[model samples]
Target: MDDLSRDIIRQKYPEFKEIPSQIANGTKYMPYFKDCNGVIDDTLIDVIIHKENQLCYKGRKETPTIDVLQAYNFDLLFTYVLSGWEELAHDSHIFLNTIGNPSINFPKPPPGKYYLVDKGYLERKSYLTRYHKIRYHPSEFCGANPRGQ
Candidate 1:
């Protein structure tokens, strides 16, 4: 995170480590999320690009758009944002590029802390994602008894 962003988090959420009682008591996920600082995801935003550059921006979706990477804390406050990546760029690719490029100054989690990400992101040391083999979809878990563990 940048200096301004860090200051905002510090000022707004001084007790960042403290999980709210409601969330902690209501969900099993909160216990395992003690070390999670926030969540990260990328989204495609439609845009009207010049015809010359449209081809480069086109991806699986027919619409021309830019993929934007964003990070948000538990409070749903935006902590970081990276924009301008072409739609063709995958989530993992953007994440890797942001962290790998020193110039980008991607906010990295501190030691023992991590950012929760979806399976589209790399399963790296500081990124927490679900195991590929797990039945993660909500629909898959529906039934009288549910299915797998």
Candidate 2:
């Protein structure tokens, strides 16, 4: 949907916009999923907002702004939110903070698979074993130096 339509919907239903949908086969499914083998998975998702503007000077300066929203998902059974921020000229970061929190209440991972993540999700071996969770920072911002370091 376009920005205008999304904004209208969001205004009408603020909480509705934050609810995560399970996407499969080009359809929005319920947040919970169950497989034939009696396995269930709970999806964790987050949203990011980006703003762009056009500057114009017609006797009086004016700036028009547009906002875009992006959603991302990670395996909650093995990850958590570490950090998320907007980059100056690149995609935003959706850092996943890993945790060892027991998965006793959650569905089990597929056989021989502890967890699964897309390429955007970062994984570190040292941290995985020690923390039992994965941390992800968008690749584009990896090389940028810290503000005061």
Candidate 3:
């Protein structure tokens, strides 16, 4: 099933061949993210495991789950996916492990480019994360601009 889904997505959307038009030209996502290639994140998907092995997969969620790491472009097409991690694993740990292991061949951002990540991951050379305690989502900017910290 995984192979089928991946094949279908690959055949339908095709991999991002170059910098997205929005970022390439001075359009909507320019200035702030002109050098951004894409986004990377991880999610926990509920899964059924044998009773004996359930303990290792149990985490915050009531049911067992597997952490799936995915990287996608601004067009919302998945460029890469690494799944089957136990739910108990931390997102940072999984991210580091994936990049450290040469066999995986993770899609690293080009020099001077980066991937926008959420608070779950740390800020690094090619990965940019929000400042701690700062409001990021637009919804938080209600009515007028934010006041002094």
lDDT of 2 by residue, 67-115 (tens): 2222223211211222222222111123231223232122223332333
List the candidates' TM-scores in order: 0.75, 0.18, 0.77
Scanning candidate 1 in windows of ten residues, the lowest lDDT window is 1-10
Tens-place lDDT digits, model 3, residues 40-131: 89888999999999997998867888898887776677777888888878889888887667766666766777888867887789899878
Question: In order, what lDDT does every prediction score?
Answer: 0.72, 0.26, 0.72
Superposition error at 147 for model 3 (Å): 32
In candidate 2, what residue range of length 10 has the lowest lDDT sum?
A: 33-42
- Ordered list by TM-score, greatest first: 3, 1, 2
Error of 2 at 12 (Å): 28
Per-residue C-alpha lDDT of model 1 across residues 1-149, encoded as one tens digit per residue: 22234334332443356553434654555678777777889888898989999997887788798888888776667777778888878889998887787776567876777888878999899898877787667775466231111
How high is the lDDT of residue 97 in model 1? 86
Q: In candidate 3, list every pair of residues with a backbone clash.
A: none
Worst 10 residues of 3 by lDDT: 1-10
Higher-ranked by TM-score: 1 or 3: 3
Q: Once superposed on the true structure, which residue ranges of model 3 sit more than 4 Å away at CA? A: 1-17, 25-28, 138-149
The residue pairs in collision within model 2 are 80-97, 82-97
